[model samples]
Target: MLLFISYVILLLVDGTKTDETNTETDLALDKPASSSSHIIHPPQAVNDGNTGTTWGSNSCFAVQLADYDPWWQMDLQVKVKVTKVKVTARSECCPERLHDFSIDVYQEQPSNSAPKVCYFYSGSVSNPGETVTVTCSRPVTGRFVRISGKNKLNPEDVLQMCDVQVFGVAISTHFDSCASLVQYKQQHSTKTPLKTISEGIDNTAACAAACERSESCTGFSIRHLPATVCELLQGEISPSLQADVTWDSYVYQGCFSVCE
Candidate 1:
């Protein structure tokens, strides 16, 4: 019947539209990303898909001059849930040079804001020319991923990378309460505990709730007086704070709002 033909055509058109919508989303997730830096040797070698082991004089390797802070970055071009980052080090020589580096993911370039530190390598890597992969604690939404730190071998902070690969897909924003703020304290603050604002709080979760509800509170340090007690802080968190204290500190993002 004519009616049946018309219904079939309508269904076919709807199906085609659905397919096109899905294709668009897929392309958005997998679109080609880009990478760049202030300086590199044999330019464009960092993310060119070529792997190199030897460093000096190799056209396939990326090397920065000793004049600036060493850094190499990958730009995903769009904000996406970053799942993992991998770095390939040059082989057969200077393996010790890769120590004391950091892998970070940022909503934008590092110049724009303080990044979420995904991983930090402080110890020496025993294997020469090995590929180091760091899986994010959770999928972090960010457009830029950077690898930076000093080249222990060079005082001027020269750096190098053979390959940098980032893998992720477009997704919603990720909140990581599990990411603890680095250890910090106020310079004049005593190592002794601040007066507890809330006693018998039960746990850090209760302490965090108090901070979230308070407008002036920037961070909270929780200690179990055998029962949890919360000490809310007024000012910013200091990373260089040296104190002999046992309680753990949880900092709110608002503490760093001024810097951003």
Candidate 2:
């Protein structure tokens, strides 16, 4: 595969450090695998015969009320400190349009009775080859999540989910979830204060999913923008657990990291 070099920029909220390493392994986008907490509903099961989106080598499954059974759930084994999560989509020609689809994040739970949804990402009307990103502002621990939705094309009704993600330091892994986001900005703002570079979902549930999917994404952010755009920035991150940078709508954990 040929990798084109693009300028990589890191913006900080305060006294935070960004990673200089570059990796392109989007393992978070790999085919869904059944875990103790999650599973994917096969294609045939959803649309009699099929429903899927293919862009180059990346294939996203269609989410419909029918077959889109798998939740892609996992166990939030430990408390994670995270920031943002970016969900990137590939270019693909489609026979239909995907719509109302949502990426739901949850706190670690034993059943769906108490499962909480982070928020639904309003996908683009024309998602030929664009990146639909979201961010979270805190560190949350959850196990089961559901990436569900459907497409609304003229002739064919389909649902599509290309990539799911989460960000944070896993209790089972060796990562860092340091101070709150506000403090990091206070001390480092001179160097890296919280500047709105991008955005994402309303809270941290989406960010958690992005972090979990990414192999190197240490953190992620879900910033709200012009009523139409949500930015999900990732890389080396800091947990935004400060007092001032708090949210009540969803899990607001200030997380930061590489764009995993």
Candidate 3:
């Protein structure tokens, strides 16, 4: 399995799609969860390798997001202002038991009596080659998040969660003056094309402006790059702010209105 060490939605343009193939930029997303490398307050449960409740499938999945819940979870941590959340089911992780799943957003940790649920997606894992993903409610907060499930494996020892992911860029950025933001990755590289060897911009506004002017850019990363260089990123829009909205209310709802 790919050691998605970072786990954050680093992003992949995926090209494009149609009826025969569905290729649209993944969609909007909320904040990302904290990776093991930077766990502030570790979850109540984790395994031997600090992967307690959140164990890396140790494999690559090819399923979609809508396929597995109560079986696998996707945690994220980022530095952007997010508005939506998307999860995909790959062929590798959370197989078989992923028919329908649920997501719960929590302002604070869900008590052991009822672990706070964030966003859940379910009902369809048959995307085959597509990225089985779904959205969440009004968007929640926090720089760190944990996605957990209850039914990822059956007695047969089948595993799900081969390839899981989250997408969404910061809505805006506030550069710290002539800083250059650099994009780093754990699973892959950034999607936005860089230019001039990744130079520094005057301020956050200038950074956003640089992104807006780029013909291929769908969005920009305000201060994602390293501090040594005030980088202005161009590509997908991302989120950096935080929220506490929950997806429990619409565990069984989805449609155009959900965009609200």
Candidate 4:
């Protein structure tokens, strides 16, 4: 009986290993990609399965300006159970810019909802053409994966990636969430704060729920810096809506009658 139990345990271990190997396919290969902004090298270059990073080789993708947060995103074309993400640093120069980057997964497009944090790398790349693999603490389910630069080294920094890859298994059934469909515009705020709640609301999700409950609420703004601030807004977006990096305004996309 002891020998039989050992054999069964061995079989189970082998089966688990085989299942993991089968699901290790790179889902982001040759997939469509978008960036906050790009200069010469387009965002598509990162997912072309090429790691070459010579100057002017077009083997990497780079953001246009040195913004506080510059991001590059990939559309898997289908929902995936993302296990890990890998990013190759540019070989030619400026590999340190990849430091303090984060990988985020979104059920909907990035503009549509806030993303869940998959992994955050706090260190800089040590070698040229070094590929950093960030394993998610747990598998994250999403169709869109984004990598954003946090600019820990400098106040403003551009993001340059030689190649980006996502490893996961695609799921057939779709994941649905009403809150995920809510649209948000970053660096934007309404002229007047319809209502401001400094306490109770801690995150964007909670702030959004407050707006949905209000009859006159058209949108809302939430900022997380000095403290969590939720501001409810009314009326349509017009010229009065000014650009403010401190706030991110969200509008209901009418996904459901209520978000909560």
Candidate 5:
């Protein structure tokens, strides 16, 4: 009887450790990536699951010379609560180029606006092909993650990375049903509504369903000012759209059929 009890306790402890280990998922694998500029390799090469240090076609992502404060960014498509970020330095060339950089997280698509800094590396990488991991000081939530060069050694300091990884848990939202059907944006538009539904809407999910059912609807805006107000929009949704603290917007991302 005592042996059986000991076995059960061991299993319980092992299961708990497994659950904690699986909490963080890699959120930046093969996601849409972009950068300031590249010479031979593009930004997508860094997150292609290849850790090769060779500065070739499928190995490294390199920025052009004279590109001061160059940056590489990844779009996770959905909002994530970022925990940590990992970057691998190139081994064949100057590993010191990866020095003095900051990892930033943004709730919206990054532009000229400032972003929340998750971690900053103030020193140069000591070893080639070394993987450096930076843990956020606090819980940071955003859809976009960026790594930018800071305090460059020279004006022409170029940023080269072999691999980049982001680890986090996705934050669930009220519009999760339409998440696979549309692209969620944190901003709203000012254009006149193609149609408006101020009644029967309880939350953003219901508002998204209403827009999905309309063939002419290109996007939507939902706000809860004591009551839910949904506005179906027409035409393209641009980043220049207006931002409100109370409003959440989404753009139709095209599907096989309207969301059921």
Candidate 6:
């Protein structure tokens, strides 16, 4: 009986190890929740799970605006660690139109904030029949992904994409409401009245929450009492700005997990 029980336990352990190894490959393809700034074919065609090349006949195709800086954007809806972006090229025509393109991933829209560049292809794709996979140097976390580049052959900037497939795992970023921004200091520890500080902020929780969700905010300052208020700063607290001790300030640690 003891020998049989031991053998069963060994089998279970091996089974668990096999499951763990397959988790990443089994991850579902993250389809775009929504798409914008596309022309001709709807952006949904890219991730519609169809990779056929019958453009105009088959609805799964995407084309962007011909104007300069034209781009295609997709909302992943939730933060994900994007491992790779696979783009299926159009075989019907104009394959060279997609030359010099970039794939950008962002927590916020690229227009509002700087995006992390995942992969860039400067020349024309080597193969029009095969899927072109752009693997990020490291997995990036973001809710939105944008593919933008110039159409070197055309007079205007344009891009042609099909079957836009994204592969990755979901992740969450941490923001402590009770914790004060660590890098900030009180602007006036001795003289500035809390009422004179700003208005609307009441506690560290509210102040921290506001800055935590903002991609542009790097640190913040708050005051207490009659008119509790908070002021958000764009970047890290600079030495010149840190000299002011009138308001309470804290800096974000800016921690996030990346792909190995």
Error of model 3, residue 161, in angstroms: 2.4
Best by lDDT: 5
lDDT of 2 by residue, 89-181 (tens): 435664224445454445545354354445555645466645455555333344344455433433344454444455544331212233122
lDDT string, candidate 1, 1-260, tens digits:
00110001111011111354463222122223333334435435666655666655352343444434556666555455566667767677655556677777788666787788777777655577778877877666566777776444555334655666666553211112222333333222232433456555887667765654443355567666555667766444445234535566655441111111
Candidate 2 has an lDDT of 0.37
Q: Mark the 10 consecutive residues where model 4 has the least summed lDDT.
A: 1-10
Q: In TM-score terms, which candidate is top?
A: 5
Q: Which sequence of candidate numbers ranks them by lDDT, best first? A: 5, 4, 6, 1, 2, 3
Backbone-clash count (model 1)? 1
Q: Pairing residues by index, what is the TM-score of model 4?
A: 0.57
lDDT score for residue 57 of model 2 = 39
Q: Which ranges of candidate 6 are over 4 A from the true structure?
A: 1-37, 60-65, 172-260
Q: What clash pairs does model 4 have?
A: none
What's the TM-score of every candidate structure?
0.47, 0.40, 0.35, 0.57, 0.59, 0.53
lDDT of each: 0.52, 0.37, 0.33, 0.70, 0.73, 0.57
RMSD of each: 20.9, 18.3, 15.8, 19.0, 15.5, 15.3
lDDT of 6 at 59: 42
Better of 1 and 4 by lDDT: 4
RMSD of 1: 20.9
lDDT digits (tens) for residues 13-126 of candidate 6: 111112545743312234453444556567676766667765774544445444566567777654666788877777776665656888888887666878888888778864
Error of 1 at 158 (Å): 3.1
Q: Which stretches of candidate 5 lie over 4 Å from their true place?
A: 1-24, 174-260
Q: Per TM-score, what order, best first?
A: 5, 4, 6, 1, 2, 3
Residue-level lDDT of model 5, residues 1-260, one tens digit each, is 00110001111011111255565446788889999989788789999887788786377987888788689999886566788898999887788888989899987788755598898889999798899998998767787999998866776578888999888665433223333434344467788898989999988778876765553465688888877899988656655367677777776553222111
